[model samples]
Target chain A: MAAISLRRARTIIRKTLEKGQEMGLKPLSVIVLDEGGHVIAFERSDGASPGRFAIAQGKAYGAVMLGMAGTAQMQRAEAQAYFIAAAGAALGGQMVPVPGGILVRDAKGRVLGAVGVTGDTSDNDAAAGRAGIEALGLVAEV
Target chain B: MAAISLRRARTIIRKTLEKGQEMGLKPLSVIVLDEGGHVIAFERSDGASPGRFAIAQGKAYGAVMLGMAGTAQMQRAEAQAYFIAAAGAALGGQMVPVPGGILVRDAKGRVLGAVGVTGDTSDNDAAAGRAGIEALGLVAEV
Candidate 1:
């Protein structure tokens, strides 16, 4: 499996922010995490709330940990609210069942990492995250 | 970036407890955090519950992490419950959205640190935090 480099992580953040700006979305916070659920890079746009860091990180962390997109987690959360809540507790609050987390995958469909975005609508956040991963010539497993 | 010194952190804790006593408030727990959200000083008055430590730390941690006073966080928590809940989880349960956290600032309006007080009523906790910062001749952004 390929790994996300620091340079690539930074690029992902930049591209995510750029997409948010082009779409005239709210100021965003973005985070890239390696497959092990470690943060590679994170940035919060000016005027974004402080909680953006945790929210974005949680989204990506959840994706990486569960091996699924945040949208799937959202469905799981709805279908199994108690289970998801327990999992969130077990993960020490690292899982966020939201729509802004996207898994990064290599061309061979191996997991690379994840990108999470916040500070706008969840749908818009996911779109921006997808744009970021695609801009880096990687697959965004949304 | 400016940092909060140990001497000042201790002073803030002392003054906070003093203000609580002067106000005839209940036993209080106070904590001071550096700009990086690390604890600098902590004190719990006699009869304060053991949980006061986590509660106080959570308040200060949230303020430092978010670049806002605990009062502001309280409002934000009300307006954005889901986002705040996710952020709290991402923080590993280190954030408590309440009114006891106060941001310490320099004369030029740069964040220096934060103080959190608990055990008393939330309003009184905030008042004590403000008094502590003011007693240290620093600005309290509440």
Candidate 2:
């Protein structure tokens, strides 16, 4: 499995914050997780709440575990609320089906990991995550 | 600025268990977290309790966040229960004061990350953690 390099993960986070600044959005918490849904890098920008880190991490974990973009995963969670709830109980309470989660793919379309952003509107967060992936010259599975 | 490699984290977990076997301890759950206190790798050996992951993660997070080994942190928590409780409430209840967490350090003694082990006596767990770090030729700041 080709993992996301720490250098690349840092770049993704930096670009994500830059995008947020460009859009005049709130300070964001960004997390980059490995393909196994473990965090590789994380940053909570100034003015972002500490809670944002947990939310960002959960979003990234869910995105990678579900192998889908945040919006789609959230839609599924909404539609299958009971199932998601039950499944979350089994997964040690780490699932988050929010709009900030986006999958990162290499040039060959292989999933490398997922990046998630929080501390803004869900749509804006998702957009920032996608922007980060694009900024890395990688494909976004959003 | 060096990040804990996934391969090294895996090795830490494996060697930790090997130490457990040598010491005749029960199956264990181990977690490795980045300096940012985010889970970078984890494992639950066979026969380990299902809840070990959560416990392991909490110990690792507490150790890294406090910049002290789990045993010392747990001791401080015991002596200053009110402070730990107040802080935990402020941090969204993610704090755990246990004896299975240890910090990982580079050869230069810079804090790199933390390792947490569960499912054994706290002393044994801490010992296994130190062994794992030593096996990797890394400093265990316990």
Candidate 3:
């Protein structure tokens, strides 16, 4: 898989936060992780809760690590917390099954990384995450 | 700015442990995370309890995530435990809003990483974290 450039990661974060601000969301945290599940960039908007990044990282990590978007993983996790937790424990406790985590795919449909957003309602957060990926003309896995 | 070097991270860990030992504290574990809040290095002194690394990394991750020291995060977390817990639930349980987490900033004032020390008094742990950052002439964001 191709690597996601730091520039692209920064752009994703910048645009996501911008969208959050424009939407008048309370506050937001965003994180970008590479295909290998390593953090590429992270940011928490002013007034965001201290725990926002952890949640954001979890969402993104889950999306990448499970090869599925966090929105779906959240459903699975909710239904089977014990099983999910057991599986997530292996990933340095960074799995977050939530709606705000989305995968970023290149034109060739190869996943390059993931973007996670948190703060507002889950649906809004997911929208912002998807918007960020689309801003760069990249695909956000459905 | 370049990524934080593992050598520097190890130095921070060594100095942190030295401080813990000088205070005659219990076995300690330390974690160093890069700018992206990724663990760059970690160590658990002899006799340290299991799960020390998780606790140490959680503290550091909390500090970096909120752009505040874990000491302060712990304070806020106490007042809003419910909110923080709910938010943290998404991150696979890596958020620890407690003392002993300190930010590491380069001479340029850029966040380089964070140092988290665990297995000692909160105040003592925080002090050791600061000591480790100071040893490298790096600013520990108060």
Candidate 4:
């Protein structure tokens, strides 16, 4: 089983923030969670709202727990609100059904970890996260 | 990265309970949080309900995390119910949108911490929290 290293997580966070800056997006909060949905690294940019931590962690947790990207969870949230709501409860409110959560995969398509970003439009957040993972030569399963 | 000192947090809790007693309010639970939203001090007056701690901490956490007083969060909760709900979920239910939470600030208006009081009416609870901060010569951004 592949795992995300702490060094890699730091790089991902740095790249994610850099991407957000380059895109002129709002200050971002980013989190990297290992395949088991445990946080490996997290950071909130200056001026970012404090709620970003919870939102970012929740997004990554949801993606890792559900074995899919946050985009899919968001679609499921629309189509199955009751189910998603129940799932959120079942996850102890640690799952956020939204974009900006992307699964990271190794070369053989094995899940490595996930990246979650917040503090901007969901699409922009997702793009930034993807840029971070791709920069590390890892696949971003968005 | 301004923070609330332990001594100041203790003073705020004492003053908050004192104000509650002066007003003949019910036994109150008070909590102070540092700028990072971590609890700095907490006190529960005798006869206060067991649930008061959670409510008080929730209020204080909400204020600190949102960088505003609970009054503002309460208003936003009404105008943006969905957003508030999502945020609450993201916070793992640690945020309670109510009036008893007040932000503590320094002379220059930088946030230092937050105080939360619960027991009496929301307005009275807020007043007690305000008194606590003011007693310590700090600004209460209520």
Number of the predicted model whose DockQ against the real structure is largest? 4
**Which CAPRI quality tier does the interface of model 4 achieve?**
acceptable
Off by over 4 Å in 4: A1-10, A23-27, A34-40, A46-54, A71-81, A104-112, A119-124, A134-142, B1-3, B14-27, B36-38, B45-47, B65-69, B72-93
**What is residue A139's positional error in candidate 2, in angstroms?**
1.1
Alpha carbon lDDT at B109, candidate 1: 78
Give the lowest summed-lDDT range of ten residues in model 2 chain A: A41-50
State the lDDT of candidate 1 residue by residue for B96-118, as single tens digits: 88899888988887778788899
Q: Give the per-residue lDDT digits (tens) of candidate 3, residues B2-115.
A: 567988888888988898888888988989998667889999988988889889888888677656677666775675443344345554456687778887877876677788
Stretches of candidate 2 above 4 Å error? B1-142
Q: What TM-score do all the candidates reach, one by one?
A: 0.75, 0.56, 0.55, 0.72
lDDT of 1 by residue, A1-142 (tens): 3799999999899999999999999899999999899988999898675567888888999889989888888787667777777777787888777889999999988899899998777899999989999998999976
State fnat for each of the candidate structures.
0.51, 0.00, 0.34, 0.53
User: Which scores greater on DockQ, model 1 or model 4?
Assistant: 4
lDDT tens digits, residue span B39-128, model 2: 655666655654676678888887788787777877778899898777667655656677788899998878888998888998899899
DockQ of each: 0.31, 0.06, 0.17, 0.35
How would you encode candidate 3's per-residue C-alpha lDDT over A60-97 as one tens digit per residue?
A: 88789888897677667667666666656666667766
Better of 1 and 2 by DockQ: 1
